[model samples]
Target: MEPREFFIEDRLERFRLKAFCNLGESGLGFFRLEEVLGMAGISVSDLLDLPMNDAPNQGSLELRSAIAKLYPGVSPEQVLVTTGTGEALYLAFHMMVKPKTKVALIWPAFQALYEIPKMLGAEIIPVPQEKAFLASTWKEIDANLYILNHPHNPTGKTFPDAEWENLLSWFREKKKLVLFDEHYRFLPGEGSLGKTGVDPNHSFFGTGSFTKCFGVTGLRVGWLVAEESFVQRARSFKDYLTHTVSPISEKIALGLLENKESFLPGIQTRVRNNIAKFTSLWRKLPHTKDFTVPQGGLVGWLMLEPGISSEAYADRLFEKTGVFVLPGSNFEEEGFLRIGFGETEERMAEGLKRWSECTDLI
Candidate 1:
């Protein structure tokens, strides 16, 4: 099958080699093993005692139990741990999406959300962020699965509570599957973490990872929350992939979840401060317009001055300043850019400075 190119990951892979100031990532800053263990209060002895073996295919009970605690009414059996949220998305789309199946997807999303299903020969109906939660979008589109990225990626705009209530009611009436990519749901905002009690129905399929909220990307630990039967099916499908995460990673993930209360507040504060820092600088650029204030998530969006190609400008920025940012074209929305501020304040300041310098030169 000739699949569509995954532009975001492709550009990121190339950026890894020469990026001096990275502003393209969409998650929290990476944490060192020592820092994570320190925050989680895990000791060297605790890690040493872990066996160097594969964890349970569906994840350890201890880890799943910790994850379940985040979502009220969810039990360990309803969670299927995977390498990361990326894999969890793959498992669900693979299982549910098929030829001719229509998927209603939120636009300007992480490419994988739609790309995976498209690869499975599914038909995609894009729902623009401006009207994503509109009753018309839900009622008008007869889709097999609806995908929503809470506090959506790139733009970070969230729907209103009333819209959410309306959508839930629609789901109850339609009984169609809805995939909630809540990777950034834990972000601090007026309604952040308010989704404590998920809809107790077979219609909801949720995927998230520790990378964004916990800043433990190296662990590659994430999970899928669905009905017990669907989770079991996903676990079986995982055997064809990585099968299971390493026990060491699972142990560390468990520690992170168990002690999330200690670190999450700090993460929220850092993200808010970084967004402030970034906006203060970004607004000064002559070429930026239509700037969207991010409600939550690590990244935000601003349109490039019309007539200037976002991809061309981004390439030029990297060339002139050694700073990297994602072009909006990667998200299928041109004339904009996604700037990440989820780094140390010092690094973010320097990156923004370099980015600003490039704007003047361009």
Candidate 2:
């Protein structure tokens, strides 16, 4: 069987490192190691002393315990630390999906959410938020599993706690498994869609990472939280993959988690400031419509003029101004672009100014 290429990631791989202004990245601006360590009151000498061996396959006990604490009532045994959320997601699909299993997936999501399951031969039914919010979409699909992303990517829409409760109740009643990609769960003021704890009787799984809200992408630390039995099964499957995380990454991640209280406030402040700057610039742009202020996360979505496709606009923008923005087609939709406001104010301003210039050419 052939696998599909990941559209957004592939485009990012081409432009991310080289772009003069990157307004397509999905996470908060990354933190330097010194900044992370400084917040934790750790010195280079402390990091230097950690052994260079591979971390335990299930992750170091301290790291797993720290991750467990993020989800209320979860035990260390219920967590499986992976290389990143990508691995956690991969493991989840591999462990739970069978050929022809019916899957319902949130639409315009991170491609891997549905693409991987589709590759596993699961029959996928798209659940668009507009229809799902209206509660009319669920009646049409008979699915065995449901996948979701919280504080969703591309659109950055979040559901209220009561809505999440009702959605989860519906899944539980149907005896369907639910997978929540909670990568942006801690994005300052975002409401979370994932449950606070592992329910002993429910087949719910949560995937998250230090890369997004924690601004520690280089550490590549992420995890899966589920029932102990499911975690154990995932861990066994992980042995066939990367086997274990890097000991160095585990050590740094532990430091960040331990000092989260000190670092998060500052990161959140920068994110909010950048967002405000982006909003100011967005108002000055021309021929843009259907734009919504992102409720949470770092990205904002906007539709361009009627005749222009997002891919064409993004290409022209990059060609003329060296500013990179993700085409909405990357998320399986067209005529829109995803603009990231996770950079410094100066960078965001320059990118937006460039974006204005490019749109003028359009």
Candidate 3:
């Protein structure tokens, strides 16, 4: 069956290649192969000797084991490593959603979270960020599944642990499945929400990747954690899709995971610095109406003046300046812009300066 156009990705496909300052990109700047190898304590000789075959259908045992260690009490048997979080989300949606299923989707999320279910004929109920954090709101809706992004995309809002616990309990009591995208959950001091163990009852499925947190988007390493039976079912379904991740990617991801301590500090420092620079610059700009300082992740949700449409603003900015920031329309909303600060400090500063110049023209 044919799926509808994926708006955000399609938009990116058109301009991403030529954009001088890609403020729409969601991940931190990439890590070079030499740097990654150095952090992992692996030499070029080790990579040269790695097997060229596809990894196990689920994932290489060592890779899966390393992923499992991120979550307390989780075993490799409960993990299914896929090409990236994109594939993991696809698998989860296919396994859990069906025609007429009622899904509560957290809004302003990555398009895939809601769009795939909509394609499957599931009845979707949009839950705004404000309502999602409150237990009172969940009481009003009857849903079979709840799809959410923690350290949410675009907004970067994260609920407190108590709220999450309450929400999870409510889902458990209602027998609703929870598919949490924790791709941007990693930050300084605080670890990912996915680090919480998957329950044996199969109530929660956490999907994440190395792309956002560790700046290894090229590796395309992502995984899902759930009950063993759930993982088995998802793994079986995976065979018909991409089947298995490339062995080379799996080996590299394994090294990254094994040496996370060596790499994370520097990555975290860069991200924190960029965020500070973006926030400070944005607050002083004339066009800046309001914005949320992202608690985690690379993007900041920015509201422009009431009369300004984010789409038009972004387009004009791209034409006048070479910088790009995603319009809220890309996320099926309007009136806001998603400003990403994932680039280096210098690049981010230059992009913001260009944006300021574009605003002057407006």
Cα lDDT listed for each candidate: 0.81, 0.78, 0.79
Ranking by TM-score: 1, 3, 2
For candidate 3, write residues 153-221 as lDDT tens digits: 878776767877787787777777778777875663255333342454557778988777777788888
How does candidate 2 score on lDDT? 0.78
lDDT of 3: 0.79
Better of 2 and 3 by TM-score: 3
Name the top lDDT candidate. 1
TM agreement with the true structure for every prediction? 0.95, 0.93, 0.94
Clashing pairs in 3: none
Using lDDT as the measure, name the better of candidate 2 and candidate 3: 3
Local lDDT at 66 for model 1: 87
- Per residue, candidate 1 scores C-alpha lDDT tens digits across 1-362 of 75588899899899844777777888777788899998788999998887887788999999999888778788999999999898999999989999999999778788998888888999999888778757667788888888888778888787777777787778877787888888887784653363522443656879987676667777888889999888899999999999989998888888877787788888888888888887777776658877777887778888888787889888888888888889999998999999886777887788777776664534
Candidate 2: RMSD to truth: 2.2
Candidate 2 at residue 72, lDDT?
68
Best by TM-score: 1
Deviating ranges (above 4 Å) for candidate 3: 188-202
lDDT of 1 at 177: 85
